[model samples]
Target: MPPFLDREEIAPRQQNPKGYAQWLFTQVMLRVNVPRSMRDSFVLEGSELRVGEDRFDLRLFKRIFLVSIGKASVPMAEHAIQTLGDALPLTGVVVGLGTWAAPPGILSLRGDHPVPGRNSFVAAHELLQLMQTADEDTLVLYLISGGASAMAEAPLDASISSEDLSAFYRRLLHSGLAIGKTNVLRKHFSAIKGGRLALAAGAATRCTVLISDVPPGRLDIVGSGPSLADTSTVEEVRRILAETPLLAPVPEAMARFLEQMPETPKTLPEGRLPSTSLSLLSSDSLIEEAIQLVSTAGYRVIVDNTCDDWDYSDAAKYLVERAREESVASIPLCILSAGEVTVSIKGQAGLGGRNQQWALRVAQLIDGQSNFVAMSVGSDGIDGNSPAAGAVVDGSTWQRALRAGMNPQNALESFNAYPLFEALGDTVDPGPSGNNIRDLRVIFVNKQP
Candidate 1:
């Protein structure tokens, strides 16, 4: 999870907007799950120790292995070590962010993210070597999560550096394009991502178990489908570059890869036969659970939202007005809405991600009505450049800032929400709640406001 979702120290929904969205996000979702029913895909039993069916017996897959990289790799690896313990007979290297420790058999590598760094280059070579030497019996476990884009980068050639890749990736994040478009662009430019990882693991059949943070999940686009076949081509990348001028002058190696796009081959059986076994252990499974729990908590969830035709301003005004309407009826309503949103970033970069920005902007639109509160946050912990996940705003939020002789407008306009919330002492902090589903926001009309 990102830092933005951790702001509220208490239950926020019945009390404020941030709380409701956080509740809907952290309390109801399963960012990771490995049940026995899907055991063939290597059950992630309590986050460690994948129990595979007869399809993958220990004797067949105990050769030298390859553990691919990503954000969730650490915890997933930790759990795997716990499950296998000293009994497992596997020799492999875990290439990922260095902060995580791999048990005695695995070696951990520290890599950078939002962009590849020096360590990423070293890790890339190591992974390339591992993939080359791995035989058909080698069991490759790909640990994929958000931020794998940079953490495990492998440009096709030496012309592109980690700095270049990071700058490119940051531009994509700020582009407001959907994740699909972003990964499509990333796939063409990257050697390790875009199924290149899988192509390397082709010498051996690999099983990829993932916890998807991307909404409306497609196995191919998550972490740019590092271990999956891609139907997208270089010409498509050129088209995106043509349309989104910000991503001009494609790297030469990337252009070459695109021009030389390989033909899609037929699916073959396991045994490193151009095959990859994959599973989605978790996703947006928490929304309905949140609806059930919050609805029964004396708050009426308005379940009929379409989120259509409404700009952020329109949505904010409508929420406050609805709060006013409900207040008159003596009913407190929790307007829960979940989905992805677009941010058209222009000029200088802002300080917050969409969720924090959404909350801050809405704070400006909503009147400090005694009965209203609004907040938003990414289901993941981090938001944009700032450290807060999201925020909660009430009638008192603005006044408290005014009393402190500060300007809320400046904070919202400049995207300095972290400091703004800090001054008010109202940020929700739910450290690493163990799930991601894009972003979640909620407006709660309460009895006490």
Candidate 2:
């Protein structure tokens, strides 16, 4: 496990609501750590691999190969190796968005995130070559997590250039459309996504393990459901393109591929392929554990599941209003939310993520309320264009920024909350978490007598 904020360090800060909020954030992050989740959910019994209740008999396969993609791919592959040993061979590729060093025997490759790049295309080609030789006697251990959609790719048509795909990704990312919508559009454009990878594996038995980063636990949206079956139709893609405001600016080749959509889209043919199974290693399960911990801490906890899709500014307003509506008698209230929020950059770009921007907005709203302390963080330990996981702030944040000769409104307007938080020493940087479970937000409301 990586070095985390020690409980002792947090203990000193816990005397006030501001310090306690940081401690609570650390607790929430600990619950969803990737290695712990993988070990808890997977077990090995001789030649049989048990993932939760599902089991795969490795004795039946002549060879086993691991194909991992996403932010958490390297760690996940590590755990799989620890569990199965020689039962599963590690002669496969692992692609992700971090500086993870793949263990010997496993090929470690870097890939782009938020948008596919040249390296991503190269990784896709490599995976395709490996999948082509997989026969019925072989088994592919497919692992995927958040960011897989952009980490690896093979265009449905060879003519779709990387530059064109990057343009499309930028539009979708800025469109503020839901991830599900964006993923659906992405699957149509990629050869490795939307079950194309599964198809390429042919008759080889596949066991897919997922560390889900999608909301509502939709398996299809996680890493664009690379090794799993996709039930989406071309009509769905068309609908998303038509409904979402220019989310997908189709290039000529991509536009032509849409016209070639098969009557029945190519998905993993479950009945036709050798036996395949899926295990959900983790999801937003951290939210439930986080709620339990907060309740045990004596504060009244209010969990809002609807905060995931709201714009950062809107979410900040709703959270503040909800806190205000609560009765004064219930002091030390904690409002918890888990979900990803969209940030549509305007004017000159700033070094901040959605969480920092949201925290900044909340800071602006509760500028006069010293009892309020709010924080938002990406579980993956990376937030937008900034190195900080996110930002935490209270009523004093505005005054602190003013003291630094910075205008809070100007910072927020430019999507530059990272600098303000850094100056205030309020940014949370935990390094790469080896996990991606969306975003976690905690708002502390402690009314004074």
Candidate 3:
């Protein structure tokens, strides 16, 4: 266990939202990485590993039906099948772009990510068909991760085309609106997200196991809550689209879907329960592991949760400024934080996420300073709009940036952190961490002179 998030724990904060977002992400990651934590935190059960009946029971259930969707779903599904052998008659589907293969008994459908395509539509239909088996006797295991919304598709009532939906999602991903708002728009366009999955599985009793990447751990947001009920209405989706000017208006098809869609029914089916029993399997589960690793390396650890509602660039600037202002002038501390940050792209599409941008921006601010080192990365390894997880920066970071003809401020403004880090060779390449809570930021200010 790490220290609490406050002065009593990690001292105070200049940017509380950034700390809060990171803390929120850390909590989610911590839960998923530790199996025991899963049992303790949420009523988490799978056909494979049954912690207890209250959470999930392998011994109590008979025929099992599994639907694994999104980037994390395949890995989660793979582990689930391996955990439970013949407990329940298992058959399932996994849809995603990653290498998350299916269990022996489970079927898999890989498709596009951050955008929709023909493959995505086909897979979505297949997933809906798979839910046909949701009956009273069925025990459903729903594995959801980030990017599931695009992978598992059910068009808005007007029937948006795959190309159009893909276009819309791409615009949103690049629009710089936060994931929360993006998801609000997504819920309106899709058939399975925003509690749509729970609605589809309305026929059977369901147990939803989720890996939350969103800041606010709303069950309805994770992979659109495949086994959960949705409260977001078509009108709400319309409002989100209207609110964010960066993103285009709802496509004609989606507008029609929003217009024609009926109010949700009160009672949900077994496949879609009245209220699906969903558990947040993990958010920032690895913070303890990270803390253990960092603490063992001979540095103090500060865990903060003020990660939400802050501009990452500004937050990084404040922390660096404050560290420079300290009387000791330098501190040997590893400021550990977690949370997801949003990047609004103002320039031509730059390749990076909020974490990478934060690292680069911090480097620029500390360009004249000495011995400041930091790394901001997605725990899952894939930050945003890039292949690498996040970024790491030190005093020489800007020097390297100059050598490579990369302007740090320009990159930050353009929202292209990955390219800048690439030029400086400071990328934090961990691939996909498999478990995603949100962002992980490690700032080592004046650790070495």
Candidate 4:
């Protein structure tokens, strides 16, 4: 939204690349920072709260507190406070990547992204203190979005140090395990995840407003479901770890830590208070919005398969082949896809994320062709460890890389696509759009000009 991309510089030769990229960026902006989803899901009237059909009377509680985490935390929390009219006896903390002005009585805590840090540790303690103060007569409202799992953390046991946790966290991220498995593991050791946060509220009435970035039907995994039920068990965590190829050898501390972890409840323990109100503000709806926008742009839109578990190379190859097959379209062909990909970064220290890697691979596959352009983007406006949201490349991209003194094959092999894309001026950076909904990709095969 803040001009992270030089639109004209990245446009393809014979296609309306600038306009399409702009529209996609607008869609990402709506999904991440805009409050339309929040407004539609949360309706406040006096002391009563309505989330879809569910309702809660906040007047029933003597004290009201808020806990917000993840990329969308600030915007969502601000919306809640504004809707609550700033006089609801609210006090709370928001932990997120970007800095934001906190409403009165709320403390804004800076949180690390993609990995938890000392700030996350401190924020976890503060959150515990806040929830520990709540009584049966109190109401705790939690606003959760993607990245909360890393943005806030506290070990359930004393065996693992913060440094150990950080190491393990990095390993899990690089392991190429799907997010659901990653979250299942995250909940096992953390004091605040997998409904532990809700348990800490004692008998307080709890409500949750969720902006889901997890796979569909898994709201319990969103923000690792701090206040919801966790259906995954420790066995699942161990199995996933054993099966997934980790980026580094498992640390001894992690092994010991996992062995010592108490068995996570596969369901709520008897008599535990579930969230009294839960609302989902965003999810696949963003994908649908993107589809409509692309179709409206006059390209013949083709909905591609969800690529959540696909390897970046495999997904890129498949989409490229399909785009090639559709090259005869009278109108331009736009292939759309949504879902995250896994990249096993086994010590490669790449400067790019999965989206860039995927696009880079596609660029290689279509190198000599002149009509195809492919892009993959993280909806949150940041991809992996790189500054770019993603990358876009046309058939000429490989040659462009060569002209810029970059070797595309070497970049892909080293898991270092970011620098190559950067040199070729193909990287797309949309600067922290404050939202997350997995990844979205678009492949355009122009009408054979």
Candidate 5:
């Protein structure tokens, strides 16, 4: 397996508490391999494909259409193709934020992320065209992951330009709304979201293989559930727009579109929806691996997800206090939390993602306190607009930043945590892990002597 965290990159700053924390993080990341997860979750025998407890016979289908989207699209599609080799003729599209040299029968397409652009429109159009080719005898295999909301999007209103769609996504990102709520809005505005993708492939046998990046029990929110039914309604969208002033006063054309928007399909369209859906990995998968590694390292592991979607500062305060209270002289403790936090940008935002922002806040709270380290990292290896995956900080981080002529408070307020962490060599740079299972956080409380 390739090392996700570089020991050399972090060696200069590793010392005592920071060294142990960085070492633990590096160990955990090295084990959280995406291709390994894919391999373990899928197995093929003869003409039968086994995904977890489910099985699909390749011989039963005439043509197999593979639609892979999101950050992990390329890897997931490649693995699926390898697993189903010679069983069926596969033709499909791989839409992703990054580029990949697709196999012979697959079309590799790039799409805009964080916001939709002209490329997103083109990709979505291609997917629609491909879906139209499916019929009663066709089998559609959807390898869906996170980031697909923007990576493949088509406006519900034909009058809405690509620029307006981009603006809509920008508002959603900065609106401080939770991902579920954000996707609710996205589902209503798009043509292929909220089960519309499945709806287009009339009578086809659909199977969805997911790498969930949303919280558990809300798998549909992953990639706005393009192949699954939606439970959210137009009424909820309007209410969200009304309450979230950040998203209010939308463009006139956009406002009109939402006002007249129809609700996403609440029930699956018969014969067109998924016959079987398998979730290959999730936030729990990462957290479970971290728990085992931490336990083996002799620290007592505690899984806490109470602040899954809380604001960055609030989550930092809660997790820090929890770690302090749980710490004891007899045994060290590792508090592991998964899922994402919300960040409402203040103004013209600087370069940082929610994970780095949260890590910075924890740094402030733990300043001068010995033996405590806090880390927040994205599983996909790309955090927001910054290049770093996330960040790691211990008790000494605050003082070190100040000594380095860096202002942590100013950086946090400006959403500029990347530069501060980078200057201190505390940023975790993993560079697109070909995976997305949400964010993972660790609060390590070393035993007091």
Candidate 6:
């Protein structure tokens, strides 16, 4: 069992499919051990530091700096300090969702997420100031994870107000664009994104350790590639802005700002770029662990990520149909998918997220069926504007909602899934898990009589 899950809360449903699915989720999450992964990936022996196959002699550098950002910032920073503090002179900054009691040599600051605010600007300013301090003799270590884009941001143009920056993010969140495209626009708009952060480090020898939340092989998209080279172009940003109707709500100042905005750095000179980088954890790790847990429990597991960037309703239909076709009456089956799904908020979005919305859609489709349960959840333990991580739904969920005088159709349409799930006691609420890879969806089919 994962340390984060509440066993007592899940005890009552132990005999049901929902309980089994929740248990599997907890087990899979337990495998996302950030500290252990960091320890395994980074090693310090004598004055030499080994990161994977690369080695760096710490004695060559005049000073070492560490920058930790995103949801996993606290744990990642904590381990780095514990491991490297005694051996090297370390000073750094951490920007995350909440306040933390930072170590003696570190500065801890909080920033807003899912949107940028004044605090985000402050954090960005501090990070930029620190990065500017590094020179040829400095070695900078960056610990980046999901949510960093919103946690620390500064508009590339100084004239862009914080309100306009927040509006840009808010529009992007509801735009239904894929994560990659969303970040492309973000990189163009920010001074700290793309390869600009590396540029700020000057000629420092930099190393980055990432906990990736983007799709497979898109490591650069994680935290908008603050230290890595950017592959996207300004033309791509223009195309996205022109094509996305959801971005219509963006402030007019944003348009004016973009018109004069210079392209983000596409290539960094020698020494300005990271010397080595490692993806310490990702959705692949989460899915791999989930497959093992289900297989060990005697279920035939099928893995598919085809629905990754699809709209919530569309993904629900595709996965549910696939589950029905693949399920066998003689043996239990579990279908797993890991990656985020897109949601286009039409008007005022109610209190829910893509995970809850998708699960609710699946509930409607499987309504009169038996022995089927579908669970969708975010690894971070918070889903969109809702307090729940996501939600779980079985074949009977529709009828249960109806008996309680709730309209599933109305709830899904208005993006108000949290209240519906909460009323049914099916919302997956684990609080913040202090980790993020991406979202996970599980479809379980029990053996038929």
Please tell me which predicted candidate would have the highest TM-score against the true structure: 6
> Worst 10-residue stretch by lDDT in candidate 5?
5-14
Put the candidates in lDDT order, highest first. Answer: 6, 5, 2, 4, 3, 1
lDDT of 1 by residue, 386-439 (tens): 666667776667777778998878776665667777778656555444334455
Candidate 4 Cα deviation (angstroms), residue 359: 0.6
Q: Candidate 6 on 1-449: residue-level lDDT in tens? A: 23464443442232677887887778777777787788887888888888877888887887889999999998888888887857767889899988899978898999889899888899999999999998888889899999999999998887878888888898889989989999999998889999788889988998988999899898778999998888988789888888998887467777887776787777775553348888899999988999888888888999999999999999999999999999988888899999999999988989999999999999999997878899999999899999998999998999999999999899999999999999999998888887889999999888753
Q: Candidate 1, which ten residues in sequence have the lowest lDDT sum?
A: 30-39
Q: lDDT (0-100) at residue 84 of candidate 1? A: 51
- For candidate 4, the 10 contiguous residues with the lowest summed lDDT are 4-13
Of the two candidates 3 and 5, the one with more favorable lDDT, higher being better, is: 5
Candidate 4 lDDT at 12 equals 36
What C-alpha lDDT, on a 0 to 100 scale, does residue 104 get in candidate 2? 71
- Cα lDDT computed for each candidate against the true fold: 0.61, 0.79, 0.64, 0.78, 0.86, 0.87
In model 5, the number of clashes is 0
Off by over 4 Å in 2: 5-8, 12-14, 88-90, 99-104, 246-249, 262-267, 271-283
Q: Report the lDDT tens digits of candidate 4 across residue range 257-282.
A: 77757765444332223455454644
How many clashes does each candidate structure show, in the order listed?
A: 28, 0, 48, 0, 0, 0
RMSD of each: 4.7, 2.3, 6.8, 2.8, 2.3, 2.0
Q: Score candidate 6 by lDDT.
A: 0.87
- Model 5 lDDT at residue 81: 88
Candidate 3 C-alpha lDDT tens digits along 43-155? 33444344333344455555778887876665566666766666678988888676544557677887777677777888888877877756766777777777787777757
**Each model's TM-score?**
0.81, 0.93, 0.82, 0.92, 0.95, 0.96
Candidate 2: tens digits of C-alpha lDDT, residues 1-449: 54553433554334666667777768876776778778887789887888766777877777777899998898888898878777765578899876667667777788888788888989999899888988777778898988899889877777887788878887777777778778888888888888888788888877888877888657877998888778777899888888865454577777887888652244554422244545454435767877887788777888886777788899889988998887365457888888888777644678888999999999989998878889898888889889898988998888889988999898898888898899889998887777887888888777563
After superposition, the stretches of candidate 5 with alpha carbons farther than 4 Å from their true spots are 1-15, 270-274
lDDT of 5: 0.86
- State the RMSD for candidate 4: 2.8
